[model samples]
Target: MKRQAYRPILITDASRSQDDQLTSRQRRYVMMMGVRVACVIVGAALVGTRAPLLWLWLPLVALGMLLVPWLAVLLANDRPPKDRHRLANRFRAGQQTDAPAMSLTAEERPHKVIDGEP
Candidate 1:
């Protein structure tokens, strides 16, 4: 019987750890919230000073205040998607793909052999 070549998974192809993803999401949420806070401050200042184009600017600032939290929540809850190749086997239901599968056949797997003639 012919033996298939051994394939090794590379660390470089691995996805980011959960903690790393969470930390980044948190940073993004905080930054967006800060922008929302800035919009509030700017709107207050514009009202206090009666800046020119007040009619146009207040609505824009109000829009920012309204949208940022919703977007921030969405982004915070989002996660990186699984790689296509990783799911190919799962959905194919026995179809062979051109890409190498990340597993070994039974014969190719490592195992202990014993002899009865001891």
Candidate 2:
């Protein structure tokens, strides 16, 4: 019997390491939080100095403060979507359900006969 040849995965098809994904998510979370901090600073500065259109500015800044952390947590915890090819088998199986499996009768099926000589 012949052994099958080993196949190597391509670098282009490889997914990122867990550490790399965690590092990227951490960076994104920090950047968004930094923006939230900026929103807080601006709101405080506006309150202290009677800025123009304070009502509008305050609500917009307040909205940023309310939404950023929620979004940051969601994004930070999210992982990348599965590759499309990973889902191909499921779709192929679904398509096959449209057709009923073929069945063969005993006479229609292939068979081997053996004869013994006395």
Candidate 3:
């Protein structure tokens, strides 16, 4: 007799289950480093070859050399924007978002006496 096995169920939430191993900061650092490598390669290649209008290309090379690291560092240090969302039922219901305006009538306002003796 042959035995059969059932398929395993995937019950995890899709968003979390498929999340990247790297955090946002790590991802940015990785991406910026990749771009930085490309910049270095291109700059070296440009300087190595006797390309025409070298003066025109000099600024590009300069920018890559000077800006790439600064930008990479900046981006790597940046944080992902915070997410803000309100539950549909919790909002616009009895949940008070704003303070109710005080009633014009004095009776509506409660008075507290310090009762301090001099």
- How far residue 110's Cα lies from its native spot in candidate 3, in Å, is 25
Query: Distance (Å) between predicted and true CA of 86, model 3?
Result: 5.3
lDDT of 3 by residue, 3-117 (tens): 2333333353123222352366577777777777877887677788967887888778678777877887776665544323323323566666533233234544557869789
TM-score of each: 0.76, 0.66, 0.49
Return the candidate ranking by TM-score, descending.
1, 2, 3
User: What lDDT does model 3 reach?
Assistant: 0.60
On TM-score, the candidate that comes out on top is 1
Clashing pairs for model 3 are none
Candidate 1 differs from the real structure by a C-alpha RMSD in angstroms, to one decimal, of 3.7
**Which has the better TM-score: candidate 2, or candidate 3?**
2
Q: Give me the displacement of residue 55 in model 1, in angstroms.
A: 0.8
Clashing pairs in 1: none
* Model 1: residues with Cα > 4 Å off, grouped in runs: 82-95, 98-103, 107-113
**What is the lDDT of every predicted structure here?**
0.88, 0.82, 0.60
- Candidate 3 is scored at a TM of 0.49
Model 3 ranges off by over 4 Å: 1-22, 84-118
Show where candidate 2 strays beyond 4 Å: 1-8, 85-118
